[model samples]
Target chain A: MADATDSSDPVDALLATVDDGDVAFDGLRLEPVADGDDGRFALETPTLDRSTFGRSELRDVLETVEEYVTNWYYWQGDVGGEGTARRAFLRWCERAPVVGEAVTAPSAETTLEANRTARETANGTAPETTAEADQSLQVPQRQDALRDGIDREWGQLCITARFVDVDEPDGVRVYDLWHVDDADSDVADLEVYDDPRTAREIATTDEDGRYRPLKTAPTLPSGWAFTGLSGDELVETVGSVYPATIANWHRERLGELDVDHWLETAERQTGIYDVVDELPRDAVEWMADACCVDSQCLRRREWEYEEGDELDVDGGDGPFPCREPCSLVVAAARKWAILESETERTYELELTTSEFNQLGELIDAVAEGRTDEIREADLGDGANRYRARYLRAKRFDDDGLEARKRPEEY
Target chain B: MQALVVAAHGSHLNPDASDPTYAHADAIRETGAFDEVREAFWKEEPHFREVIRTLESEEVFVVPLFISEGYFTEQVIPRELRLEGWDPEQWDSDGTSATEVTLSVGDANKTVHYCGPVGTHDAMTDVIVGRAERVTEDPDVGEGFGLAVVGHGTERNENSAKAIEYHTDRIRERDRFDEVQALFMDEEPEVDDVTDFFESEDVVVVPLFVADGYHTQEDIPEDMGLTDDFRLGWDVPAAVDGHRIWYAGAVGTEDLMADVVLERAADAGAELGDAIEIVRAGAGGSVTEPADVDGTAGTTKTGD
Candidate 1:
């Protein structure tokens, strides 16, 4: 429960302002007794029973508010907490039109009056601020702002926390965490989970049932949510879906992220991976460009060649920072080192200019993971499925490409 | 006193690589020996760099569930844990030495007693023997079958082969098997030559590696002619090259590995007082036997 002992805060201010008449805003209604029987008042919501409390029992009212709003995605810790990924996400939820227009938008009259007042004030003239703007904008009820719910998109997940009419207060607040694809689907239409571990299982595969080696790859499947999770449970589910994302994001905000650069990480390799250190510095850049791109991974790489020697390529633009090169990178570097050790050899092959361009287009399409988007019917597209098949049929023989043998075979 | 951490090299592709580690931790947790038992991974959640900070315990015992003492145990875990006295230059220094290391975490000091890996423990010899006997489904199967211990050997680190060789020698000295020969995956006398190396008509190959991942599940089985197609599991006692062979899964995945981890941690805990005493004596401080040293034996221990 939120402590409401302080009289100067917004909760007490709202409580003090409610006179003998009732004040109604959002889904809550507060009324004061005309008889003033022990200074008691009734606080009522559609989902919960009307409860009468004395003026001194403000903490009980605050507790009810806390329980009600927190269930509706009003994460108290992140609301006024450090500017972490969670805080950034909340800001996006309130400002960006995730599902539709922003819910906190003021009335049309209020907006028009504010725009006119802003134009006059900026012109350095006597302020023509409407009398209604001062009362509605400046002196708006703080309680109405506190009761606001959230609806936002995080990765592929559509999160909705809002008040819903139900028989009990526990059921008043409903939180729905589902796939963004299923935003229009009813709750009964989607598969629901309650345990955090279920998120880990869901993350193991993609839509085509292929194993997702990279958890943060932009291929998370749809149609499921760990619905009705508490704030702690929701965080745990997110952690299981994308491990260490919150921790790394928080560490970066605190400026305490320990980044192990490519050279430092490669030098620490032992066993068969010790050969990774022997990779030429130029080859390191190529590996990062190939593997650390946003198309392949979803982490913002913080590591570089070393301190003050950033890579020429762009790191990913993910919301969370990758403090070090993951094990997948290290393992891949080992194989790359072996491949890089081979001597350069040249073999002659005949191909037309268009054929060479088509080959490049094919490679680019595969590398950027856009092959699936190139439909087989799109024959005009060089990297289309059927077009690639035709290229393979023309260039490939049983022996090798273009009937050309390798230098070693010759 | 508060927690036991079993650290292992997990794989990003194979979720089952950490299954055995989690199962062992759960088994130990059910025993109620410690307040918490956690499994940290090199390639999974609760990563080595962050698992320590998540611990509420002041005293922690970290036991590596690796097959042998090598790169990961010696360099990676210590550096990731940020041990107070870890020196990067000392490549030959054994990080598995039963010693108390202080982790300086923001002014307060936390004690982490690093224990030797469970794979190199003497009790692991029993795990190998158990794997052999279970695969054969006979208590006295060692009398007729030659046991082959396979390891992921590398020229980069001679210690990887040494651990397998030590276990092979230990098993041979007991005279429980008809024949025991150490085989390597990357060195000579490879696991592929298992059927031809021994005179016995029947052989039982037990992989002395951690996790039943790629190596134990596919590579070794495929190379030994136990399975023609690439798959995860192999039904053993299949005839190959005129020899009937029983291929067991990786020894680290065996249920007895939980006991091995507990043994490693308990041994380090039992030696903690002696380690302190030796440091005290080296500093010319008078050492006296503590009066409250309990003789109760098992996994749980009290730290003063």
Candidate 2:
């Protein structure tokens, strides 16, 4: 219930003015009383004074309790008046969004978004991680890979390549390079090319038509061509063009006919998969693909006969919501994610992606100093040393370091 | 193919109020990552219903241009986009059409896989910094010395500050800046506190509000002691004493906002494929349903 003494004087004044502005609302409902006391004038909405605007004008509605606050703390009762004003404010504070929510709503979320937009133009000290991440992210990775391929082939094709044209359907764009270069340099992975190698490749193709990795760095073209090259002499440049494979999509449900067949068959024949089984192999496969969760992982967790060693957690995906609202799960998952993320960095492999990686991939994927990529690869195979579930542990040295392993493995 | 729709809470009282947003949209459209750029508002020429009704593309990428993720972001935009109860495959208006519409919270398509709103881009900070530069560029003629950023700060959304703070911080970093501060139409670092808190040479007060409305024209000026716009000879001081002040039009007042709004109608020429055939929807930016402005909505140029 609202503070009994609020009197709706200040709030009422706000409503009156805001309404007079004729701010059209899809559904505007202002309930003077949240306690469901509509008939009584004791809790009449400030807008109730209008003859055209009826009681229902505030139904299915939004409660925009805009207090004519002198300061930001008025709704929070921080202004500190003794009697009715303070009491009413305390009640207002009850309805006022919590401090964290307000902060998250106003600051973190807003800053993150606007910072993203102004990222290109704004000259602000890249305040925090999110902005930094965008800086790295905006760099086209696939193009970088192609450039890297070219660089390895030709030797630092062009790291200083200004974007001549990034938006191209040809899978490649051209950049004007001052010089031509040799194509076979292994250091390609260390750089970025001005244009996709294909563009340079086409322009400087030798008579044999063999893609000379190090085509002499081509002559300059117009608009944001390779400006200046730093490090390593040779006016000649080597390059490679690698196919942009669809790698690690955030969500992908594809090429799983086997599971779909299983689901369809089960849905028709036994009819059990629909009710009892629910998730047919095909359906599970699709979900796995959609979620980017491995089919093997899904299969291992679902099968009844599997040892506890196969599963990471006791409950499987049940604990996770396939759907969201999930604020609880999202928040919890965020903690685990953050832990994994930070921990992954120390690993030799660079488990989680971060902006700093562009400084270069992590030396290792150390979940707990487990040396990232190498460690995970070394711990390879879907083999389970645990009791019932599969143990997905990376090697600290040879043996896994921490965390409760699968039951059988334990 | 992401169709970026810059949705806004429109104003019924005035059309010019939508100008700033259209301007911003125009700037974004030139970037060209979006398959289409459009704007949907609660009011003004093209109402929300007509905008959504006009979506010609299979998918729409909605970016709520609101500064906060409050009632509008959480409730209204999602509700309007019909995001509630949407199954991924069927999340679109026609389910199987591949015509999809995603509601990006703020501009983080980095996580969502879709190219989202410009808010997340560091490049956009350039706009704010640029806007501020406009004020600080000249004192007697342009905004010089004192720089005041007037934003609509809400306690509910910390995001509103991202724009204000980003611009303020960026300008403050410059050598030319005498002083750069942020003031809100609402909440803390408010208009009232401008004189007491901020210390700068010449004040250039830029309205963070998307449009010139009650707050920008009426409230902000009144708070800054320019209470009387009607006076002629006195010369409206951008600031009092050494603290000079200037006014930068709302960031949203760009001409592109109109294109963003017009883009919502997929059939509206700016769309891909087959031309949008409307009877009288010819060139001048006019519409019959919600009333026109001598020109048809679809035929109007992309932005102001």
Candidate 3:
């Protein structure tokens, strides 16, 4: 088994990690590609395998995975920057327990911080400028708090507290705190106090009025707590509310796969085929000389099939080229069979051949607006019953045929 | 071939509310254009669910016989028909855009085209004009006569008034009458104030409704002082308040509406061929070209 970190190229390094054995997670299997791009990969399941699909098919499958992952977690700016495939993979590893442990990838926060540092270093910035960079990052936090103040003054707000090594501002670590205040106005403007009671006093005190102590301490909102969660716990908390964002972050980390090719192969194997000489032949060619129904499907001159292989066909004697019946052929055959069977049966009619022709002419005359007379054929009981059924059938086809007849009153 | 279902907001107390709707269904049925012509209502017998149960065709077209694109047309009809892309529970008061939806019902797949209410069609304006003309002694000599279009306006939704206002504007554009005023039974300018807006001695009042239900037969006539009896059939020009008020039946009950109904069905993809002839034959009279009343000659607008 090849190790991921051994290769210089990140994609190659990741591909080398997939062993010969199947790696399954959430019903998706990451299988090694035998012949593909240098680091090509395939994802499969019981019913679907990327290796059997064509180029466009595989591409759609891969794109679906990509889109799903992107929508899930990467949508949140908290994850790695867009288009950073390596960082995206690392994020996936951190989220997907099986895949994450298999690759031994670093945490999402660590990778995020590392990428940021690398980006800053590439921009020709010195290590000493880290302190200035930290200050700029705090701007968003301040803006969020200010906006929250304008919207409402109630509820517990989350605030971050930073404790820096006094001698080294660059060696700072941050901690989060849930700030609960009962004040109805300017909650953002109040200074941080020891607890909710003190915070409320400073927030509620009028500009010209003296500070007064409350008789009863205010109760915090149900879930309010002094200590805040961080790292994985923080990611999990955010993921719970925005599952799509989390799913994207995890999927993108699974690395890229050749999805279009796999999809095409899968489609070719599933559609209608002609069973002849105990082999599956192109059903389209045998039935109709037309391309596959799928507009984007690849036109194949020959389809490979093995003898005695149980093809997925309706009412087929054995494993043959034609696996299943196309809807067009089945419908045509069914109609033809019905017509053939109906021709064999005879109906006793009371009307002569000449009278039947007159009836047809009269019906046409009414439809063409030549006459308004509604004349009924005076056939006997059995024939009249059959005529009524025939009229009912015609009514189903042309709702207005009978209406063209003038009533007896007219 | 598709099944055409005429969906109506049926009445519980007044059975006559769905009369025009049923008449329209019979007219369409005679046309022979659709495989099946059925009537479905929100509140009456042969309910929507029951009507859907009898649908054997794979494609269906639901034409709402509403006077306007109001709450019933926008929400109720679509829900009852199971038209694609609509969820009655998900609907909000903000209103939804009128778009046709294709949905599947049971083993058969159906593309349901929920058309606009018949009253909103431009052709209906011609029916209203025809109804007004029929009741008046001489419709051509209309230089001094007033036309009052009565509608069942509601305080619950503003769409009812909007529809009436639209017809009033269309009628005014014709320049046939001296004055055309849109009055509502519920909202302002109330139907009771019909005489206030007109100075003409002879006023032709046409009900812009689908049927001669409670509102059109009872409420509108009583408000306009056309009849104090509160009966189902009021004699035209019931001399009242020193003005000769010529009361007409609901615009939807006009024979010309059979053409509009077929036009609506055709808009929903029902082929119009022998069906047109069928409607003409059933009408028992010369079928007026829909182009004559649709305002836009040769152009028929369906589903609004």
Among incorrect, acceptable, medium and high, the docking class of model 3 is: incorrect
Report the TM-score measured on chain A for model 3: 0.18
Ranking by lDDT: 1, 3, 2
Q: Give the candidate number with the greatest DockQ.
A: 1
lDDT by residue for model 1 (A1-410), tens: 12211233445435654653564433345678656558777776544567878888954675657443332223222232222344323333333211111222366543443343323312333223222111222112322322354565555666665444432323233455777788878878778889766887788789988767667777889888767665445655676677666656645534456788999989977667789988888888999998888877788889998899999989977767777777778888888999999887676687888877888998888888788888769987779988878877887888658644367564
Question: Native contacts recovered, in order, as a fraction for each?
Answer: 0.34, 0.00, 0.00
**Each candidate's interface RMSD:** 3.4, 25.0, 27.0
State the lDDT of candidate 2 residue by residue for B231-276, as single tens digits. Answer: 2111234545446555554544433233323333332223433221
True-structure RMSD, every candidate: 13.1, 31.7, 30.2
lDDT of 3 by residue, A1-410 (tens): 11223544322322343444433322234555668655455765323434644333544664434322221222122232333322322232222212222211244543333334333322332222211111121112222332222121111234333322223222112223343342333435444333322322332222334221110112222223322232233332222211122333222223211112211222332112111222224332332222222211111112222323322322211101111222223333334433444323333334557556656765555444344233355443223435546645654345433343233343
Clash number for each model: 0, 141, 41
List the DockQ of the predictions in order: 0.24, 0.01, 0.01
Pairs that collide in candidate 1 are none
DockQ of 2: 0.01
